[model samples]
Target: MTVHSALPDAGWAFTDDAGPAVTRLLDTLPVRPRLLGLGEPIHGEELFLRVRNRLLRHLVEHEGYRSIALESDCLAGLVVDEYVAGGPGSLDDVMARGISHGWGAFAGNRELVAWMREYNQGRPDGDRLRFYGFDAPTEMMYAQSPRHSLTEVRDHLTAWGDAGQLPDDAALIDDLAGADDRWTDEAAAMDPSRSVGSSPEAVRLRLLADDLRALLMAQAPRLLATAPEADRWRARLHARAASGLLRYHAVMAAASPSRYARLMVTRDTMMAENLLGIAAREADRGPTLVFAHNAHLQREEGHWRSDYLDQALIWWTAGAIAAAELGDRYAFVATAVGAIHHRGLGAPAADTLEGVLSTLPDDPYLLAGRRLATALRTADLAPVRRSDNTDDHGFFPRDPAHIADSDGILFLRDVPTDKP
Candidate 1:
């Protein structure tokens, strides 16, 4: 069933008014979602980021959003948050220390950070914008060792109360952790046999992590009472990161058939936890704008074909889990582009969503979720394009079935890189 001819008229109807376009899209949502997620089909494209920056400005200025969370390392994001909140630091240093995945070098990100700092200047603490990274510390190339988080939690706790109250096992954890190179071995990603997950040291470390987590929970009341609220919050963050990173490492070392699946799920689980924590900390004060890839923020099950494993794996995204927990309070707006000249992508096929959207003028627009879904269901939406080159690949199809799961769509008829 080719949708090339049966496709609905361009229902987006957005024109020169980008702000109003965004407003109309948000109005269609069943509820005002707290987490207003904006997903880019590809990464590091200045076009997408520029649109994102525009929409984010509108959301913050008009819609009362106070925080912006990215797909970078959650723990490392503290440096960014501090800078944005009026802490002292040069832009260059903040960008270097704050962003991960080597994204600090992005022109769009640099612009975004600079704008954030400028916007924050002279603003009261209550009015200052916050920045965050909701991703786990782990990356595709390396899963971070648990030492940092564990040590942080221990140090924070020790500062507030009796040092003896906490377990005295830093040396043991260090020994068990071994060299960072072992945990970061790229070969271990494909060959489970190469993983040290099943090693006796790893098993023991898991037990220790569980105990430490339990101890944190058990001692929370006392810890909170004795420490400043700020200190307590920081301690909790460390505890959660410590426990979560340990679990991630444990999964990485697993010899089970489901190791990879568990590993993916674990990463998203931690992402969800971090996002929820961000939401909880802020409460009903102000909305948050989350920036990530479409896969991480979409409500549908995320699928990726593992080149090494020779099979596809499906996992729940952070957005999917948040929707289950937050319901209508979580909203998502996925960005799709019609063309990316650098990546061999051209105009969208008439049957595809991008193609359908291409009929509109060359500008950023937002489409109603239900309307887009209806059009897609009738138009025979294209199949999803699974690839390892997600950062650079421009063409990605949207499964029509998942359209309704999103709150809205942000479409750009053409994507041009901001690179020199």
Candidate 2:
């Protein structure tokens, strides 16, 4: 069967090799989303990042994509965005300060930013590419201080907001924030008692965060009239970070059984909001390519289990939220990898989705979501074998059920993590 044609009867046949021919696969999607999400099975894999760069380059050249959003810090991304848009700064400097969660250390990310900058040389604004970091600044067991976001929004209000609506004393926010360690304490994640979120000062800060958000909205007309695009974006970004951190801290202080569940849900909610904002901003320019973990971008409810949690937590992911609102305008393409020998991961079991794809000659094959799921299933959906690789590496195997949940799947025979 040709790559351009539909699935065959004798088993799935390769068509496009997940290269520039990815355009063919994307053209088959039901709708061209303003935000096209590409999810990876794990983070920090050089191969996945490189593949994303390649696919996005193709999309920019062939499909008119103008922006790329990553799972890094939204606030930190602005620096990278500015650099890519011809702002002054060396690539090394931008990589260190512009990317969060230590993702800048990855060579692949540096290449992506450098390429975006090079691509923008002498190009007009509309045709030049854009960059964004959509994930909240929260981690599994560590959440950052909300002081910067809180203070930034507060400053914005003082500069533009009406006096009567503003906080009585601007310094109060700084006082309430107390110390950075109170919020950044790693122990707070596993033990809520260590959190200062429910303290009197922290509660006041939460209320202040809410007030700041409302004030920004109420004064949007005045602010927008006076503020430039960058100012407006920064104000909104600060507002989002402030609000998200307050909510996350509140969860951290709760000694309830659903602590981790609430934390995970809160983090993804922030991601979803940022994604929606990106969609709105890029609606006129062109489509965007969002890259993140498979769990964050899948349309199905996110589920996780660990010794820390008593029950299996199921919550809506960013993709589910975006899909509910954007409908056909949001599409998810999941990447299924065959093996990463370096991580002790071997070839996929013949019964698994990755295993089935390993049988094909195409190193990377683009398969239809629903059709492939049906073809691979006999009676009920057989579970995709969970990775036998050590858990410390953070590898997640394809959940057979999720293959049908996605709009498409890009299967790779090997990630070449050992590097050629």
Candidate 3:
């Protein structure tokens, strides 16, 4: 077995340009934050995930961070959270059922959950770690039906049994929800005409969902008094996801040119809201680590371009939205890579950000985003260029504009096809 040691003070100071790799996360930003977003350029590769696991373990041990949130289904994550918090279930069951988007298949994620479970075995409540999913239940292919989220809200609020102004008939939700396949139909994503989003039943269901969510909030005080913290938090999350699903479907049903753009914006909006809720929940514990793609996590206008769309899609990223409200309480670290061998990518030209960073001795290192951006602006090392190496693969290179607003950056010189 390979032994991994995460010394708290291993790397924080970048002595000169491209010094030793940064190992600590807290002091990289201007202020200590409750939420720190760590972004990856692409998904599915275990290299970035292993690095993420290492960084998170370091933060948990040294920086007083108690939670780690992923870009997965929030509802599904509650199950993983329960498993890690010493609730009933085998590791295999939790991995298969609890995690969303097939992320459980990733060895690094399984390792992360196992580590968290093991770490929480005897720790005090305050010191124990928690897992969270901050993304919307929707996906690029299909948006899950609001059936589970809505029913969960109803069941939680029913703890009061006779709560004032709450939806009484669960049958109404079920009847309106109709069939699950109607909502999960992947074809509806591309063809709006087939979507059941704008139908009268859906519209009514949206209103009912809104009412149920409001009722949950109105009766929050009573629920908190009777229920545990986890139950109350999850009830609220279900409400949020239900409402977000309704809104996402509404947009998905639109036949306009900006349909996909609206979908992206709505998905990210749900993500930002989920993260904010997560921050609130973990406020009493300690800081949190939020991990996702660079586009979803950057503290700037999020952009997605395609040859099919007449115009590029643009909206605020989850990090940008959350940071606006969090102020100094939020920080971001974007990961950039020089090469991805599996994607047939190779060395970056000396003129790009990845190219210059690749020249450093460190295999993977952290740079203060602002200072790095400043240094690059003076053209001391090389003239910067927007990365073109990622045109083929989903992998993206760091842009000069992105670094200024970010707190720090984790850059890898090369990406091996196999797990590191």
Candidate 4:
């Protein structure tokens, strides 16, 4: 039942018998592979139910993973709020009639709600399952405007600190609160043209904001720095900075609606990464689930960008790094659900590389075939040289050697016809 083993270096391959070892790990009593996937669709309760059932069966019956960590915004606070409001009600009641019942909320997913209720029903009183929201509001706030005024940034930080959500570090709070004034004084001391832009006042304000952020990064625990119990604080600060900058940039880019749209997309990406980091920290205590976008979990190392530079990849890597640093156990599971059929032109359809390659020129196919031949012949296929278009929607192929060290992964796609 033990899944632990020495991880092979980057390119090692497993033998044909690798399947049994993976199956054995899945058969183990307590090794639960976390579920990381996209959000619920607009109107697909049936689809949601099916997915939830599969996840539940695997966790409760097969792996015995009791906790369900949802990727919700304000998840912990939301649950705590609901619990506080409805003292004796179950989570289902809370979802159906209490806090999560208003219009435009997730009230429609009755089956999923019921499952969550039952999951929490048997737990000891005051020991309910933990729900951690990975969304970072600071990034979202910044995305609202392109050019944040010094006053605006300071106000946002102060408000967050006042709220119990942010840490009550007196020294850190004081430094951030005074950051605006310091930026202004420094800007005032500099030459007008260099310190400010063509519009001296406007440019000065922007420079002041930048200077404040730089000062904070220099003095505070920046994202890369190692500090005790600093992850939460660093996450908050980064989220705030990202959200503020996003909002400021959006306002400036308002002239080009298309460009502004792109910025918003980038902001979402940044927010997702921040949320993943937060979720990872919350789950550090034990085996936990991470519900998020497919893009956030899939390994993108072979793609054009360096793994270290990509935000989502960075988030996953950071979790692994943090787990190791804390001496806490952890494992990653990548989930991908493909489309049944192509819908329309200009719309993304789930098509495999093999399927697409069939329509391409013979020369390219031959080249690809030769590359596959090389890979199969060589036991060790360097990860860097792996092709991105091998599987469904280029889903990152799981290297058993990489994952065998911790726990077996569960590929939720292509679900079996009969239920367990």
**How close is every model to the real structure, measured as TM-score?**
0.89, 0.92, 0.91, 0.42
- List residue ranges in candidate 1 displaced over 4 A: 1-17, 161-164, 168-172, 385-395
**Candidate 4 local lDDT, 2-86, one digit each (tens):** 1111111111122223333333434442433343232221112234335544554455444444444343333223443335333
Worst-scoring 10-residue span by lDDT in model 1: 2-11
Q: What tens-digit string does per-residue lDDT give for candidate 3 at 362-384?
A: 56767677666655664433433
Q: Return the lDDT, model 2, position 247.
A: 89
Report the Cα lDDT for residue 226, model 1.
88
Better lDDT candidate (3, 4)? 3
Better of 2 and 4 by TM-score: 2
Tens digit per residue, CA lDDT, model 2, 1-420: 432132333223333334445665566678778889999887778888888888888888878899999999898899999999999989999999888888898988999999999999999988889899999987667887889898898888777767567877556877778788889899998788999888887778888888888888999998888777678778888889988988898999999988778888999999999999899988988999999998899998887655335578888999999999999899998888888777777887666667666666555666768767666655343475665654643566668776777877877778775532
269-377 per-residue lDDT for model 1 (tens digits)? 8889888888887675698899999888999998876656666779999999988888888998888777776776766676666767776644666777777676556
Best by TM-score: 2
Q: Output the number of the lDDT-best candidate.
A: 2
Residue 142, candidate 4: alpha-carbon lDDT:
30
Root-mean-square deviation of every model: 3.2, 3.0, 5.4, 12.9
